[model samples]
Target: MYDRLHHFYQHALALDNTPAPDKLTLHFPNDRPRKLVLDKSKLSQAEIALLNTLFHTNVAVHHQVTQENEWLYEWLINGHSPPKHKLERLTPPPLRCIHFSIKGELNEIDAFIEAIKNVFPSVTNLLWKSRTEGVLLQHLPEDTVEEELSVESIIDTLATDFLIQTSFFIGSPIDSSHLLYERFKWETTLYDAVKMTFRKKSFFYEQEIVTYYLLHHIPESTLKLVSTMLDSVMNDRELIHSIKTYLECNMNTSLAAKKMYVHRNTLQYRVDKFIEKTAIDIKQFANAAAVYLLILRLEAK
Candidate 1:
């Protein structure tokens, strides 16, 4: 339903954390983690009232997103390139975006900023996309010996201070300064979609971005069909767990057995049995990808 309604509107931001000022941010009581954004200019008060009555949701008419800094407002809200002057003026390259998503309200903006600086000493810049959305610009150090940043620590700090369970995604380093805005926006969209799946306060990186994209774009019908390819494995709880762990461990029998607390020979037997039952050459990347996605699809369901 969310996707159908989202497709109908040309400017829908299907669960975007940073709701553009040009779009109307609608919140449904049922869909708490998502905000269906649309161009409110295209909706009259009468139409808006009717929509409210029909969908049982509230529409927040954003009045020109001018609350943030001028450059940030333009870059994030208007989807404009970062000002050349600011790019030239600020610190050098190697800055990457850390897109954050928090569940509840943030009453202490000052404290939140302090916590960010504490967690990331090399943080060169920062900006809030919305109350629930923010971006931290970090200048990753050239040297590798510095203290490693623990995502759990940062998550705990924010949760204790702001009383909101937060999740963040560390984007790939911006190779080109010109692509900074575009790349950050893309990561923010991905973060918004993937954050809800993570139960604990933690972080993710660029490696999982493509997997999440497939999860978002693939239809349930196709996933259901894919599951049928390995229905026997899916039906048996042990084979399901064993195969998933084995594939996730890169099809290494001993490593998967160690991870799953099973003997190597036992895992190898299970693997052979699964291949004989399904006739799937799970060692191949393509076959592994389909099975991995099927497992993820069922887990998500």
Candidate 2:
């Protein structure tokens, strides 16, 4: 049964038998002790229900945590709101939503929640979006630098405590509670694309990744036009990388030079050469951004 199901709908089915919190699953009946899975995204609710009846079993929610928040469950599981009134009851903001993705099935959910709370003590809302993903809505503490360190600590602890890998996208603050759903949906969607495109990085910040995320969506013809801005320097790998490092270091010649292992003067000379060739002074942030995105487009190829 498993082999036949996998052969037909493997493109949409989960790789393993474990179901997502948002997916519908039919547990084994009295005749056998194995899970019967289906791709909920490809099947209507009524269609899945007929299969559930054929299997002589009832459908089950993949995880217990999702069941606790009826309103959250509706949004996450059903991919729709519970009702207008329920959504409007969200807690007041300056709340920031942090999205976490688990790499494998995690058994230490209790420990994981504790870890999140220990690092971010201001957590006001928590929900399991899927069996392997969670979200937290928290009132941010004032220490900006500390917030990043704490998120890193959570990753470290997850490796040690849960023995599973994970990543987080720390989202921008939602100034109003009413905009939570719209804002979260947008942020999470962008983070997912960025994470897929840049699989090497584990942590993503909204402010840091948004530029690349937007650039990734542009047409190739549009990218080519941006590419022309740095036409001469496109093949100069050293100069391009140095400028990228320099811009990323906030155009501080000394700092950029230190990171590039070159003298301050040498770094400035490369910067001068770049400006001379491209006629685009990267000293300004806007011009630098265009050049930066162009370099990224080249590297991606």
Which candidate gets the maximum lDDT versus the true structure? 2
Model 1 / residue 54 / CA error / Å: 26
Compared with the true structure, what per-residue lDDT tens digits does model 2 show for residues 141-232?
44544434566667887788888888888888877766776777677667766666656567888788788687667788887777777878
1-301: candidate 1 lDDT, tens digit per residue: 6667777765534334443333445565676566576655465667556665676332221222334355665565545467578667655677788877678887776777778777877886666655666677788666655565688887887888889888888788876667776786677667766666534426787888658756766776887777778776677888888989999899899999999998999999998888889999888889887878777767766
TM of each candidate vs. truth? 0.69, 0.66
Against the true structure, candidate 1 reaches a TM-score of 0.69
What are the runs in model 1 whose C-alpha is more than 4 Å off?
A: 1-70, 80-83, 145-163, 196-203, 235-238, 260-262
Which residue pairs in candidate 1 collide?
none
Summing lDDT over every window of 10 consecutive residues in candidate 1, give the lowest-scoring window. 57-66
For candidate 2, the lDDT comes to 0.71
Off by over 4 Å in 2: 1-68, 83-89, 104-107, 141-154, 218-241, 254-263, 273-281, 284-287, 297-301
